[model samples]
Target: MDQQGNDGWILVETLGDAPTVIAEGTRQRQCRPLGNVYRGRTLALVAGTIASVQASRQPARVLLGETVNGIGLVVARPVLGPGGDVLAVQVFTAPADRSPPAPHRAAGWEWNLSASAGPRRTRWTQEFRKLYGVSDTRPPHAYFGLADLYRRVPRISDIAVLMERVDNARPGESLSGELIARRDDGTLRLVRFVRRAVDTPEGVTLRGVDHDITDRTDAGELAVRIMDSDVAATVHSVAGVHAALVDSYHGYAIKWITAPLPGLSAEVEGGQVSLLHGDDLGAVRPHEPARLPGVARVSMADGSWAPHAVRAFPVPGYGSTPVVMVTFSAARPEQHSQHVGRGRCAVPDCQLA
Candidate 1:
C-alpha cells in the first residue's frame, strides 16, 4: 500500500547486483535520483525494509525511514524470487508528522480548568478523582478551593516564576515540571505534572494530566548514589554507553569534565550520551548491542585507541535498556575475557578470542 493506501499506487523497484532501478512509478516529487547504485545515505532505511519482510515472512510495518531528502514513514513489502529469497522491496511513503498523539486514558487524572487563572471551575475524570483521593459525591469546589489547591503544592516557593511559565505556554504545547505535594492523607509525594494549553469557548483553557513518579525518581536517585565511588563512575545506557557521569563519593551530579582519564571523557558530557567521533555523526542506523561486558576501544583525542572494561547493569526506569557503567582505569588487571573483536585490541600481541 502506498502512503495513502493501495489506491495511491507503487513507487520504485530495483533488482540485485549491478543493481539498477528496474522500475519507477509515479510520485516522482521526492523519488530517488536516477541510476542504480546503492547510496550510503538511504542504505539504512533500505536495509530495514528488507530485514522487516524477511523476519516476519510477511509484510512488516516500520514507522520511519531515512530518505534522501529526510526521514519518512513507509510501508514496505518484499517481492520474492522463485527460491523464496527477497528479490526487491516495494516501498510506499506514509504521512509524516500528521498523526495525532495517542490519547491518554490508562492511568493518571485529567482536568480542564480556566486557562487565565487558577481554575475558576474545573471538571475531572473519575480516574483523576480516584488518583488524588477526591470525593466524587461532593461538588468539585467543595472538595478543594483554588487557594487550598495552591497550598497542596509544596515546591512552588516562587509562585510568580511558575505562573509566568504557565501563562506563556503556547497552545497544544505541554509545559511539564516536577513538584512535591501533600495529599489529603498528609503524606508528601512527588508527582509529575503535564499541563497543555488549549483554546476553548471561554478563552484559552488548560488541560492537565498528573502521573505519580515518586517510585521512579526515588529508585533513580538511589542507583546513582550507590555507583558514585569509582574515579569516573557513570550511569550508562544499556549499550554500555554513558548516560551520566557522577561524583560517586559525594552522591552529586557532575556537569563538566574538562579533564577526564584520556579517551572516556570524549564519549560523555554533562550526563548525556553522544558519539565520540564528531565526523561520523550525521545519520543514525538502528542497532542492537551484545549484553555481555567486553573490552571497548575508545578513540582518544589524539586518535589512539584505549581499551575499557565496559559493563552494563539493569536499573528500573532506564527504559528497556539497562544502565551501563564503564571504566578505563589501568590499575585493574585486564582480563582476556573482556577482549572483543569489533575494535583494535589494546593488549600487547593479543588477538581477541
Candidate 2:
C-alpha cells in the first residue's frame, strides 16, 4: 500500500478497494495528518481514509503544514458546496512569509472647535469672532481659514502677544506697559494697555483697557512732589513740633502738634524771626488753632496744643487707612519757601514775607 512521489507518497483507502490518487503534489512527507486514523494502517489506507472523510464530511479546508525546509504555516477557509453546504475541502501548503496590505492615507483636514455648552450648533468660526471682537459681517469660514486677523491687521500680532501673556498671568496679576502700534485706522499711538485674564468655560479670555498715560505720568509726578513738600513744611512750622515726611501709599499726609523749643528758637531769635505760624497754618488748620483729625488728642510736642494738619487724599489705592506716624519736627524756611513756589501754600498768611 506504499507509493513514492517527490518528497513522499501514500496509498488511498484499503489500497485494494479505494480509488486511485487524484491530486498529488511535491513535499507530501512534510504534510501532517490532521484527523483521527485507524491503528496499524498502511500509508495507502491512511490517505484513502483522509480523502473519504474530506469528501463525505465536507469539512472546510484547514491546511496544517510546513515548507520543505520545515518553516511552519497554516491556511484555513470555508469550503462551499453547490448549495453553499461545503461538501469537501481544498488546502495548499506554503512558507509563513507573506506581504501585508498597503498602509492607509488620511481622509481630510478637520478643525475641531466644538462647543461643549450652550448651543451645540454654533460654529467655531462664529465663536472665534465673538471671542476676539471680530465682526460677524465678515465671512466666518474665510476668516479662520486664512487667519485673517494676522493677515488683514498687522497690529493683531501685538494683540495676540499681549493676550498670550494675559492668559498665562495669575488672578489679580496685570500687565501695565507702553506699546506703540498702528491702529486699524493706520494712525500710530503710544498706548498703555493693561490686560487681565479670566478663566471661562469657553477658554481663557483677556479683558484689557488701553489708556493714553503720557500726560498723566508727568502731572502725577509733579503733584506727588508738591503734596509731599507742602505737607512736610506745615508739620515743621509749629514751634516745639518735630516733623518728618515719608511716602505713604504713594501719596503724602502731615502729622504735627505744638511743642516748646525754648533755647532752639532763642539761638536764632534775633538773627531773624521767621514767623513760622500764620495764614499758612490757617490753611492746613482752618480753625483758629489747627488740629489734625484721628490723631492723639494729647499734645506730645506742647501742652498748649494738639497735633493737627489738613486732611489729605487717601493714598491712591489705599483707601482711608492712616499712615503710621513716622515722627514730627520743624521744617526749614528754605524748604517751606520751595513748597510755596510749587503752589502748595496759596494762603497769603502762610506765604513767607
Candidate 3:
C-alpha cells in the first residue's frame, strides 16, 4: 500500500498483514485519530471531512474537531507533503464551557460639591435638578453655584450675616432660610434651604436641601419695606430733627435722631452728622460728653438729657451748630468711637455770646 499522503510518518512493512507504527513525533501524540476510512469512499466525502485536512499542492487549510475521552477538542490545519498529500496534523484544545466573571456593581449616588479660590458656577446632580424643577435635558453647567444663589437674594448683607452664623455653628447644627433664585426658564423661585457646613478635600462645602418658598419670602420682604417707610415718615414728622434707621444688636431696627433746632441751624447740623458711628454703642458708652463751645444740655423726647461735650464749629456764612446732631459710633466692636472734640461758634459776626 502507498503511504505517500502521511509525510511525517515513515512506514516500514514487516512480514505482517497490519502496518506497524514507529517513531511518531510529539505532534501525533497530542492528536487523536480520525475514524477509519474505506478505500471506496468518494472524493467529495474525503474533501468534506473535518479532520484538519491540507494539500501541499493547493495551499488550502481546514479545521477539525475530535472527542478525547468524551471531551470535545479542536485542531488547526495539518501539514502536507510535496504533492497534494496530507502529512501530520496539529491541534489545540480548550474548555468551551468556562466564561469570565461579571464586573463589580457601584454603590449609592456619586455627587460632590467643591470650593474654588474664585467664584464660578458648577454642574448640579440629578437630585438637585429635580428639586429645583429643572429639566434633565439641560446641561449640568447651567446650574448656579452658592455665590450666584446669594446674588439672587435681595439683601446681600443679610446673606453675609447668615454665613457668619453658619461658620460658628457647632457640629450637626444647621440653619434653614429662604433665598431667591432664577430658574433656567426665566422664572424666579424663593428656595428655602437647610444648610450645614461639611469639611471636604476641596475646602468647606455646604450641602443642603432646597424647597420653594417664593410666596412666603416675597410677603416677608414687602412687610419689611412697608415698616421701614412708616418709620422714616414718623422720624421726619418731628420738627427740626433728622433721623436715620440703624440695625439693633438683635438685627432689629432702631432710629437714631439728631438734636432739634431751628431751620438754618438744623440744616447745618445735618451736614456735620456722620452717617456711621465709629463706636459700638452696644459695647460701651462714650466716656466724655461731646458739646459745642457754648452749647448746653438738651433734653430728649423720653425726658432724658445727655450733655454734648464736643460740638460742631460754625462756618463763616453758615449758622451755628444745630442744638442736636445724630451720629453713629466710629469705633468697631472691639474699639469705640467716642466724643473727641467740641464745636464752637467762634465767628466774630455771631450773635450768641
Candidate 4:
C-alpha cells in the first residue's frame, strides 16, 4: 500500500498529459505509475485502449500484457462532465481468462425533445454497422428520420415509442428495451438498445448502445419487456384497444397490454394473460397485416366467452410462426380509436362511460 493507504489506482484525465494516482493499493509498488508497470508492446496496447475508451465514452474490456496476480484484463469506464464530454477514465484490473462478450456497438443522435418526431442528426461507430449487419463499405448517413429508423428496427416498428419514453423521462433518468432488427442479409437478430437523454452544452442529446441479445433473452422474459415498454401506454393513448404479443406456437403468449379479464385465463403472467379459446397451435404465417378472418372468442375472467375483434400484424423473420402483435377491441379498428365500445369491457358488467 502507498504511504497514504489509498487503493492503487489512477484517473487518467482526458486533457491531462499523464494519469494521476487517485488511489494507491498493493499495486502501488508494481504499477509504478504505469511507466514501469507497462513496457514495450504492452505499453502501446494500453495507450490505444485508453484512447478508445475516451473516444467512445463507453466502457471497455481489454487484455493487458504485463502480469500482476495473473490479472490480464483491464476494464475502463469513462466519467463524463455535464457537457457530455469525457472527464476521466477509471481503470481497474480483471481476470483475462473469461471470453469477451459479443462486440458492443455504440451510436447516438441529436434530437429535439420538443420535436421528437423530427429528423435527428446521427452517427455511429464502425462496430455499430456490424450490429445491424449494415455493409461496412457504405457509409452511414449523418441523419435519419423516424420512418427510416423504424424501417431498420423490425421489432420496435414504433421507434416513436422509444422517443416518447425519452421525451417524458425526468432529468437524469435512463431507459432501456429490446428490439429486433433484420440485417441487410435478412438475418434476424435481437438487439437491446439502452438509451438515456443527457444534458449537453448545446442542448439535450440522446445516447445509447446497441448489442446483440438474441442468445440472451427467452420468450417469457421478452414478453415481460412489453410491460416495461411504452408500447401499451402508447396504444392506450391512441386507441383504447389493448395490445399483446402472441407466439401462437407452444401455446405461449405474452399479453403486453394492461386490461382486466372477464374470466380466468389458461395461463396468467406479465401484463395480461393468455386464454386461447381455439386451436392456433400452428405457427402464424407471414401475411399482410389484416383483420383476422373471424372474431376471437377469448375466455373471460368469469366463465363466459366474449367474441372480441382482433387485428394481427405478423412480425418479420420469425418465419412460419413469428410473434405477432395483436390488438383487441370490442369495436372495429377505425371505429374504436376514439373510444372503447360501450358495454363491451373485458370485465363483465363493467359498463363504459
| TM match of model 2 to true structure | 0.19
Cα lDDT of model 2 by residue, 41-104, tens digit: 2333334434655456442222234343322232322222112222122332234564222211
Rank candidates by TM-score, best first. Answer: 4, 1, 3, 2
1-353 per-residue lDDT for model 1 (tens digits):
12331222232322223222222232222223323323464455655665677556476555654435343554665544322334334544435553322222112222234434422333444445555554335553232233223334433222223454654555665555555555656455555554556565656555554544454446445333323222222221212333222222211112221124434332232222231233221111112243233344445555555554443222222122222222332322234224222322221233111
After superposition, candidate 4 runs with Cα above 4 Å error: 1-52, 55-70, 75-121, 135-141, 156-161, 217-353
Q: Estimate each model's TM-score.
A: 0.29, 0.19, 0.26, 0.39
Cα deviation in Å at residue 168, candidate 4?
A: 2.9
Worst 10 contiguous positions by lDDT, candidate 3: 102-111
Tens digits of lDDT, candidate 4, 128-214: 566677653534443433323343454343443464476455435556666766576756666655445656554566655454555
For lDDT, the strongest prediction is 4
Model 4: ten consecutive residues of lowest lDDT: 22-31
Give the distance in Å from residue 260's predicted Cα in candidate 4 to where it truly belongs: 36
**Model 2 segments beyond 4 Å from truth?**
1-164, 213-353
Residue-wise C-alpha lDDT for candidate 3, range 244-337, written one tens digit per residue: 2222111111122332222222112222222222342221121223322222233333343333222233222211111222222222311211
lDDT on C-alpha atoms for all candidate structures: 0.37, 0.29, 0.31, 0.47
